[model samples]
Target: MSQTTQPLHFARQPHPSPVAPEQRAELLRNPGFGRVFTDHMATIRYTEGKGWHDAKIEPRGPIPMDPAAAVLHYAQEIFEGLKAYRTADGGATLFRPEENARRFQKSAERLAMPILPEALFLEALDQVVSIDRDWIPEGDGSLYLRPFMFANEAFLGVRPSSEYLFIVIASSVGAYFKTQADAVSVWVSENYTRAAPGGTGAAKCGGNYAASLVAQAEASRNGCDQVVFLDAVERRWIEELGGMNVFFLFEDGSMTTPPLGGTILPGITRASVLALAKDKGITVREEPYSLDQWRADAASGRLREAFACGTAAVLTPIGTVKGRDGEFTIGNGRSGARTEELRNTLVDIQRGRAADPHSWVHKVF
Candidate 1:
């Protein structure tokens, strides 16, 4: 991530018609994930010659875009998802937002877009969260933050756009899954793959997700909560689930997930879980695990439990797995003991309920 010579100053533009306290309270009471947004959003612009400028914390609304914008045709967009949690003292905190900024830089580099300085990216988040602190829900809730950038240059050429827009918007969310269940079922996608070798799978870009929608829909049709994608080449190695990383626990007290060579995303939550597991004296491996191996191990009682981890679904136990051939259950089809232990440890640190030795939490308000 690049460093700006001078700190970018954000100009505040209060909403002309802000939501009343009563209405906002009502919305916050039942915000539902990604349904209700905060009153304001943060924005910054970039041009070829001039660097990132026009920083502002303005009212949440639409952006007037040109029909001929490059993003419209070429789909040059990247985004990051993090959350702001309300602490016990009514203060708000962010969980390793700088890491998100650094990942955003890597995503930009992959998409051939200019990198916004990490400081600037963070300032935008702070601005949005600080100004809309009221939207942060209490008790196991958070304000979900979406930071995204898109090529905005009104040119139809095949080259990368010369201009871009970076914006951060917040939503008061309760939980990602409506059921808020401990365990979820997954469908092994036989027909669809998320990304190919040397593709944008590692980047947090819209194109990667757009490509996964069909596979996700297939999972839903198969009566599962999410889709588990296999390697694009062999179509047998377990790569990842739709939007989250998967992990396996063995009876020998070892944990394994797919190695992030190139195809799978390097998830922040996945990394944190690995570190936490190691601290608890559990062995963690990033070795390749095939679908055949997974099924065999789960059946032979070698593999105890498996779970998916991400920002949205912090850690959900994988109770059952279904595919074209058959379905299998993992460890009594319930949340496993080790899975719950690690999730509680991670969430405690994230929510400021426990001591953070890694200093991952960043208090924004």
Candidate 2:
């Protein structure tokens, strides 16, 4: 799909009842994931014939939806997640926002939704970040941005909706995990699989996540922090966690992660970690890793470290893997040296403490 010819011009409609500085400060002190929201939100409407229009920054509140909305019935929706970081110089920036935009476009295509122009996507990010700059917390915290689109047309038909709503909202969030040193344990879900061939596995859609909730609940019930899914067909190859991609670090300074063969979400953080590893002269491979092989390697001391990567968790070390077969500890059940090194490197680049050779940091101030 191609971009619309008309340029987007966002109209400003400030929130009348913004939070006071002291109250906002209290919320920012411990924003905790998606618990806290900013004062305003960015929105744009799209019609089949009129294209995207009526771009505006408005107050954060409930969206009016018809009881028979298309999204409510058919689930034509997609979203993107990225964060705005607080720089060392008292400024703010985004980490590879264009990448998120491109992924959003891909997701829209897979779900038969309207393709939002990349320029407009970036502009939406800028508009929200600029308006809620103070919502960005200091130190280890940042403003988490969630841009999503859904079918708003009130219809009962099983086709693409004629009307859609695209919105960008911001939340001040602290680290996902309480401590970086504490590695998370994962449970292997033998009864469920995440995606299959020709499925919406690679797309950042809501349905994919909604379907994984049961398995995630299973993980929590099993005394685990996360769930790891295997391939659908053979049910042997390791796919990924519920929302994050998996990685295996070998003792020989080599890294391997499941290949993206239409069965895995191409995470921006995953790509960044691969690039960072290669830059450090570490060998990185994208290939299928079997669950049996993972167990054997960890047992035999071949696998040195394992971690999951995503926007929210960043890079989290997978210290232990528990399954129906058995349980095994990886690298003393703690975060390894390479995992710590790579995590620090990425955080440094995001926070402007190190040189950005790839120009991934977009300054918003």
Candidate 3:
């Protein structure tokens, strides 16, 4: 985790056969989510004694991997997701990328992976965005940035790998949800748990996501947009969605979210929403919320709104929730006014269309 080198200097290797402008434009018209990629990517190597070195921004392609790479066997991999938006000023900006960098460090620590320097992390993202700026879509679209690392040492071992690879890739994406629904329906998962105490649930690793796939599929089968996981111990306390954090808004103009107790991802957007809520004079609390209480409060008209927040979706209102026990709807089963207000406020700042009192947006171009 210690850096023996001064700083990373990325070498450039432009794409020999970059996508033609007409084809790129056609592709950008519907880049979807993570399906479309830019022309180049940022990469760096880490060794046991050399720290980080051989950094480069090269043509987008694959790196050959040995069959027994440590990452393949041990699953020591971490990743981060953020976005770069095209502002009205004809430039691109990133939303709280430094926060992503810090969280990446924390994820690395939890996964027993190498701690990439925060500055180097930021620089890597900047280089990737700077080179692939054209890939950024217009309107509500954005360039999704994915920063990842994995153990590459070609050995079958139980301990940490001495060699690793870090890379950054970008994709042009539209709305996360394919549908234009005002709110998304959710399914409560009682049979499966997303995380437990002293586990890697808080980490942004591949394993946690891979484990959630089955539950997610269950949600899909149940006719829901996302799956909500409860606490492993009680199986009733509301924890989070498969990939997002949860928030409960009360009629008393207050909101509460599950506290970060090493079982949640500690989302960057979640923190920003809390700060924005406080700024708007809404009382915000970080505490435990039980599923039973959520149902009761919703039924009693105390819970005005509920939403999920994450880097990808930003803020998605939870209109209806269904489980084996029963089903419940939040506040008319539509996006609440307060929810819209909060999302608009956050999006305005992200798109550089409003005041940035918190300085969360970083200009990349």
Candidate 4:
């Protein structure tokens, strides 16, 4: 594990009503995604003076909170998503989780909340996965871990909460897409913006995602799988999708993605993809890519491929990019060779089938 040693103190709680084996088996047969959870969760409390305390692993249930909780009103919350893979040795491992921890702290800082120390973050993750190791599904399935923090203070005034709570929960996830081969279609959202200059676009906060729902709905109506958002200022430069980062492949054997100008989430998968591209001796650029550039390239066959990356989907090939003026199709409405190669390289390292020269994978046990 590429993590600093941290002592995890756990208070175990027996689930009063854990799912029966038959029920769990039924769900496991087709676990869809993020619908069902394990028997327990990990939690830790924080206050202004005491800092983080009462760290414990508790039953999977609700946390009693005042109606006026800070998170409910002011929406001061942050979260991280990563997976624990079931290795061929029957052991479990987490993929580059320390990166997620660092991003969590950055998100908290953006929300004006106390940073959950790296030690605490890793400990909570270890505790939950350790106690619920059986929940780590086999085959291509995984135990999706969600670590989140929110202000629990009940006061109506919202400067920054003095009280906060951090929790880690695990769920059995089958696949982000039913079939990995299906090329995803995207709708270009011209009006709705995911983030603005000096806004919380970079932060993995609820508000940023909430604002993109309308655009996502439009995509669904247009028979598209996802929505592509633009920068709030120019509205010409491509930003990202509703829940994933975007990337474009050029004919010169180079790739480009929108730079993280404090207006985009620096995805762990995005960083990992760039590293893998460099390993393959491919040129990668993190620059401002616009819709016009993509359109022109597609028309001239210079843009060979496009894809989206995130912890959930890993890598999603973009089949079509549709907007008001018109729509441009890429690679015959199917996954391109370059897109498949990139996806395979990532999955190989993640599943331990290939050597992780970058040392991105971390063993959980």
The deviation in Å at residue 193 for candidate 4 is 0.5
Rate residue 204 of model 3 by lDDT: 90
The per-model lDDT (C-alpha) reads 0.92, 0.93, 0.92, 0.87
lDDT of 2 by residue, 36-63 (tens): 9998899999998888989999999999
**Steric collisions counted per model:** 0, 0, 0, 0
List model 1 lDDT by residue over 40-81, tens digit each.
999998888777888999999999999999999999999999
Q: Which stretches of candidate 2 lie over 4 Å from their true place?
A: 178-181
Q: Which stretches of candidate 1 lie over 4 Å from their true place?
A: 1-4
Clashing residue pairs in candidate 1, if any?
A: none
Worst 10 residues of 1 by lDDT: 1-10
TM-score of 3: 0.98
Please identify which of the two predictions, 1 or 4, would achieve the higher lDDT against the true structure.
1
Candidate 2 minimal-lDDT segment of 10 residues: 1-10
- On lDDT, the stronger of 1 and 2 is 2
TM-score per prediction, in order, is: 0.98, 0.98, 0.98, 0.96
Candidate 4 at residue 88, lDDT?
A: 88
For residue 255, give model 1's deviation from the true position in Å: 0.5
For residue 231, model 2's alpha carbon misses the true position, in angstroms, by 0.2
